[model samples]
Target: MRALIIDDSRAIRMILGKTLRGIGFEVFEAGNGCEALERLQEIGRADLALVDWNMPEMNGYDFVCSVRSKAEHADMRVMMVTTEAEITQMIKALEAGANEYIIKPFSKEAVVEKIQILGLIP
Candidate 1:
């Protein structure tokens, strides 16, 4: 399987990439939403995307909206990975078409379990 991880922090990205790779996914990464979008355009499709809620340009909210706006990517699986702890923010992400979320400081097991529960990974 293939997945895309969008995050501004190199540390977070590396952690996520390593975790997903261990789960048998071929991972692609981007520093922010725009770069993620660019990668999407070039790569055609990603089986799943792990997106951070905050970033320098085009936060995950905007990225979700953008992805939903496009017919080609309308069904993309987008999961918010962030420090945003508000229930309202989680609702907003879902409203914007995110498939799931992983809160910040989450353990690798939690992340993996959520992805599995969301049916993104086997």
Candidate 2:
């Protein structure tokens, strides 16, 4: 499977990338939502995208909306991996088209479990 990790922090991207790679996913990364969109354009599409909420140019919520708006990327799964832990924030992300949500400082097991629950992996 192919996965994209979008976060402003390079460390977070690296950590997520490592976890996804360990789980047999080919991972790509972007520093923010705008960069993620550009990367998606270049790569065509990814099976999954793990997005961060607060970003420089564009946020994760807007990114999910943008991806959902496009027919070409309709099958792609978006998971918000963010620091925002409020119920309202989670609802907003889900309503915006996110398939899953993960709060920051997460365990690697949690990430894998979420992906498994999404049926992206066994």
Report every candidate's CA lDDT. Answer: 0.91, 0.94
TM-score of each: 0.96, 0.98
RMSD of each: 0.9, 0.6
The top-ranked prediction according to lDDT is 2
- Residue pairs in candidate 2 whose N, alpha carbon or C atoms collide under 3 angstroms: none
Candidate 1 lDDT, 1-122, residue by residue in tens: 78999999999999999999999998999999999999999899988899998998889899999999999986667899999989999999999899988889899999899888878767
The sequence of per-residue lDDT tens digits that candidate 2 reaches over residues 49-98 is 99999999999999999999999999998999999999999998999899
lDDT of 1: 0.91
Off by over 4 Å in 1: none
Model 1 steric clash pairs: none
lDDT of 2: 0.94
